[model samples]
Target: MSSHADHPTVIVGAGPAGLTAALCLARYRHRVIVVDSPGAPRNSASAGVHGHIGMDGVTPAEFRARAWRELSRYTTVERLEDEAEGVSSAPDGGFRVALGSGGTVQAGTVLLATGVVDVHPADVDGFAECWGRSVIHCPFCLGEENAGGSWATVADNAELAGMSAVAFRAWSEDTIAICPETMPGLETARATARSGGGDVVTGTVRRLRHREGALHGIELADGRVLERQTLVWTPRQRQQPVVQRVADELKLTVDEAGFVAVDASQSTGVPGLYAAGDLTSRWKQSVTASTAAGAAAADAIHMAALLAAVHH
Candidate 1:
């Protein structure tokens, strides 16, 4: 058996949460190894990171590049571009993390920052072509860029349709809520949309109409088309495979949405196992929220280590 390589902490996933935690821990002179895959991040489709203060409008790729460059200043922080295959608790109060690259490491603590994957709207032609540019999920993230433009919100249910219609109105006066006929609470949603100076349509969206990657409209199954310059739709999300594996291995409790359950301090109930970002939160998936959670986890870890050393 290969000997266990050791570190103070091991962070899985290199998105905002993991990177932020790694940076915070490294600043405290803790040894942190960040393991991440080369796959695209959840927000890779976003044109910029919104409501991130200094980083407003920064592209996801550029944000990561800048973070990694900053991390280079801290020698205690190490990064490995490999996927984590498995994780298990060691006998000595550490964690054994197995990598897909056939390597392993033992760490005093583990932070699962593995983010969620979005399930896009199915059977929508041309939607994929303009996903990030003209089609978006969060109005707060991309609303300002397309302000005053014709917008449409496709909801899977009446509640969401109502909520989104009102929210989208903040960005564009010409907003419409589209709901399938089968969805319940159609009247309620329609009422809310009308109250917000928007209109509601009940029909199955057949496809998206786009010209050269720019979204132009949405077509209904009944052959009617609504002219729209932007589309906002929330895709169902699922936790990454690595997160599920870790949860099962450690028997960690997860919320109904499959997000790892953590306390306000970001502790995962299991000793030395923590989680942050989208894997632990759904409603607040912004960059600022993730960064805050990561920093809080680092603080908790630092305090725990201090108490341990003093007792020892």
Candidate 2:
């Protein structure tokens, strides 16, 4: 039987949250192993990290590279460029994390920082090309850069559309909500939009017209074209597979929106299993917020370990 190596903590994702936790734990002289796979970060298409103090406008790739560089200073942190396949309870009152590349690591505590995936509008053509650029989701993340431009929101529901239109007026005066025919409460949404100095157009968006990744406008099924330079839509999001797997394996409580239920300390209520970042939050999905959550989880783990040692 192959023996599994042990660590103080194991982080399942190496995005902002995971990296931050690893850095914090390492700085405190705790041994941690981070398992992550390339091309899995959801923000790869984003041009830069927005609303993050000091690191604002830094590209996602650059931000991760710099974080890894800083983490290299600590010998206690080990980063594996591999996917975390599964997690199981270990005999020693810990957890065993299985890596896709083959091997297992026993961890006294586990921090799942795996983020969520954005589900783009499948019916809208050319959306994939303009995503993270001209077609964005979060207003706070990409609104300032495209301020003053013609903005529109393709919302899934009337309430969301109305709310988005109102919020978008801060960025541009000419804000409109492209309410699809399937959306409910169209009149209410339109009223809300007009109240906020915006308009609501009920139509089926056929496709997005873009040239070389720059959005030109959106074409409607009724052959109407809305000449908008920028489009904002709140895409549906789903948790990553690793997050769901771990949550199920450990029987962690998850909210209706599929976010892991965590306490103020980022604990999942499953003893040493913790979760942070987008996997556990939806309101504030920014680099700064995720990093803060990671740091908080790390501090909690460190304190728990200290108490355990003292009692021992």
Candidate 3:
């Protein structure tokens, strides 16, 4: 039901990884379609692309802009604005990708660039409202924002203090790694905290107290109020594999950690099917994802050439 039903390659996301793949494939004169999801990855739980070599400190919006500038060079590249529902396998060894609009993009191969989103803690006052503002998940993203402000690193686990406190103290001289109840590492991290001239708080944070859209402080369970303007924590992430659903010919092999098993070139268990970026279930940065996407696309082209030779 797609307007361009017979495209040779269909990309599922318009993210940096997806767009980069599309731009490369289009330069090779491969028929490509890029489906744009309604929401940008920046709008979600992702802070920024980390570990980029040249673009190490670039923000998410800056990364997206640079990618878009390159993508605009292609006139043959077809871009669709829809959320990919799932991908199905075709009898001819291709793929049929279902879109939310009840259409399907049939392609010879599929690549997924959609990344994972981090899980946040439950409703603890301004927890949700302060996202990307006063509350941050990654130290690299929000560390500079809360500089010189009283900061708190609230962890569900106590052991995170050693690492979190070490990292947090770089931006804030006054950092407290708080856990609800005392377990272990309370002393060690607390000692480490004092070494960095920081305080250790064992109070159960009832809620994040904020006013005027800026973080004010935290309300403690025992009615003790703490004066901290910024909070940081690390959370887990969840991924949706888009390519595996459509390519019935390909077999997905994931690790015990639920990451897709791939070769050096990022090829999956299937021949024509390749995945790049966060879809491989790897802990990724922009540089890694971009390098992986280029490598996978090159591998796919080589395989395609070999297949053409066999047929010829």
Candidate 4:
């Protein structure tokens, strides 16, 4: 077992990205500590992860467990149930990472796998009322769960209304793309929806309607109500960094999406700092997220080892 205090790299987040990064760093004999913040829920937006290449159908629990089981064999790795709050530079050119519980991690480097989140109205008109059971975000994750049942997509981005429609159609036989415009693509979308046993409607969704905790309909802005069992949307990705204030202190470059800019190895604008996973707009899939993490961890370990050799 590794002493948590001895870890050279402190990783923030315990999701697929963070866990994968931790395993990679541990393989290089770098003591690693993983902090999840609130941890992951079973019904998390990401139901399962992919892109493991050799491993598929890896559930969240199984993915973490297998990595943890193996990471323990290589070097010191500790899984802590704490939310990383902030990080700053140390006088000796190392780093100080703080947690919500007032715990601190002293390290030569920090790996931020804090991931991105798509914001949705919290239960507006009872949408929250049917989440997980009926209302959902990803079609690939929940389409089969409601197979043969009715489903619809809410158009948030006018430009990508067709994207959601096509995604929904590919997932289920019954799908619809809801938009305010009766554009030419709607016909194509509608036809595609029909091929999947779905339809297209034009209206602004006011709220999701539910009864007995089951999704039954959606309320429109004009007061007309449409009945549907499921609501889907391709989230406009929003990236939130864990160290926004500190980034400015360190003069880091952030993109318009608010993600820390990175190179091939996930090195950021600041030295001794790296980022990976959903933190960048690389892609929204679990596989890409994990791969980014591994890349970042490998880079961190390599860089740290090189720095240590220089001093020696």
Candidate 5:
């Protein structure tokens, strides 16, 4: 086993992205240390992971377990079940990762797979309980199972409301978008929704009604009820607190959309630093996308090493 002084690549966040990267690096006979905080994954509330090709319909826990099992087969990889509390520059030319367990790992390269955190609506009754099950963000992940049922697409803005409503219409024709009356683009939202066989309702969601762990309807503040089986809510999202802290320390470039900016090879414009998964793009935040990003980051690192050796 290589010691910490060897400066193995340190990967933060052990979700699909981090784990897949660790596996790829191990296959290349590169040393890696994966640090994962001890908590439920962001998608733990989800019943199962979808759009992951062969592993579709697997629960988040199951998917993680399978990845762990596969990674254990490699000797060059290490797994740490602790939070990465701080990140800083090492004495040498590498990076230093401080863990919650009062230890630190030295890394020649850093791959940040830390994903974003969804900001749930506050003061909404039953919203927390139904989140990830009945209340979801991604249609590709939860739409198929909830298909053919009434869906209510709730958004703070009319544009998102209309787009979400139209997207949900693919799984169910009984789709309606609910937006605040004061939000802009309501006319466009209404037109778009109508074109997709859906409707736009202007109202404030007072409470969500769920039974047996499933949402049944959405109650408006005006005592009106919109009978719906599922609610597709696109809430605001932010970077994980650790990712933000690291970005601040390293002065990493963050896009206007609040995501870490990375190049085609997942480089964060900083040599020996990379970021992948939802931290880089919000287009398709799925297990498949994450895995692909992880693989790309690993390949980039491997190629960089090869080029350096040839130059020397």
Candidate 6:
């Protein structure tokens, strides 16, 4: 059993990043308290986690179950199925994490693995059903599986539509860039799409034709139907409210895209505070990246504790 004062770390997420970090720290014999509520994984809507060696193609639920099972073997780790409502600095240079279930956790260090949230397009029928299956987010993760398949990019902005189309060209030459409104770079994106034997269309997606998450075509508001199979959509994303609240309290810096800014070591620029996973890097948002970040952050925390003990 570990006391609140004795716990070295409190992780505010149970996703890949936080779980991996806790596993590493457990191996190092450091007690860690991980806080996470069920049904909050950013990848819940993703069909399967791809690009992770050995664990590739594993469903998010199974991956999480495996992680929790592994963590259970370590007696030094504590798992709490609760959301961290807020984080504040404590008097002893530690952190005070307020839990949604009416309690406070004191820790010498805090790791913000609370990832971002994707803002899905509203009023789109069948979008929710086909989100993780036919509508994909990461090309590197899910592209190869659907290679040579008819593809479309349903983007709100022209840049995303064009970039997605250009990127999808490697997987499929028959790609279409679809945007709801005309914007700058659309023509360039359209040209790029055409260059790859693809096409571009501007229309609002009314409904997606799919059966049990398998996309068949995209129906437009004007009764136009694009005979496409898979859709590559990169919707707008935002930090979870808890993340923003913590960032505001700590005055943490954020990148231009509004992700929590962290260095190579996953340090939040505030001593003893760290961040990892999708919350820190958008380009490297994957199960592999998150797990690696978690491992690295664990090592850093362990080393920091060693140095502190020597100094004391």
TM-score of candidate 4 relative to the true fold: 0.79
What's the TM-score of each model vs. the native? 0.94, 0.94, 0.79, 0.79, 0.95, 0.93
Report the poorest 10 consecutive residues by lDDT, candidate 3: 1-10
The lDDT values for all models are 0.85, 0.86, 0.68, 0.67, 0.86, 0.85
Q: Candidate 4: where is the Cα deviation over 4 Å?
A: 1-7, 38-59, 181-200, 211-214, 236-241, 307-312
Question: CA lDDT of 165 in candidate 4?
Answer: 47
Query: Which residue runs does candidate 3 get wrong by more than 4 Å?
Result: 1-7, 40-66, 157-159, 241-251, 255-257, 279-282, 285-312
RMSD of each: 3.0, 3.0, 4.5, 4.1, 2.0, 2.3
Per-residue alpha-carbon lDDT of model 1 for 48-152, expressed as tens digits?
898998999999999999999999998888898999988898887789999998988888899988888888767778777888788887877888887887999
* Predicted candidate 3 versus true structure: per-residue lDDT over 82-170, tens digit per residue: 88888767878777788989988887777766665656666566777777778876666557666877888877565576556566777
Tens-digit lDDT string for candidate 4 (43-111): 353445544566655666777678778866764777778877777888877688887898788877777
Clashes of each: 0, 0, 3, 2, 0, 0
- Of the two candidates 3 and 5, the one with more favorable TM-score, higher being better, is 5
lDDT of 6: 0.85
Stretches of candidate 6 above 4 Å error?
A: 1-5, 156-166
Tell me how far candidate 1 lies from the true structure as C-alpha RMSD in angstroms: 3.0
Query: What order do candidates take by lDDT, descending?
Result: 5, 2, 1, 6, 3, 4
Q: Relative to the unseen true structure, what is the C-alpha lDDT of residue 91 in candidate 4, on a scale of 0 to 100?
A: 81
Q: Which should have the higher lDDT, number 3 or number 6?
A: 6
Which residue pairs of candidate 4 clash? 123-128, 173-196
What TM-score should be assigned to candidate 5?
0.95
Better of 1 and 6 by TM-score: 1
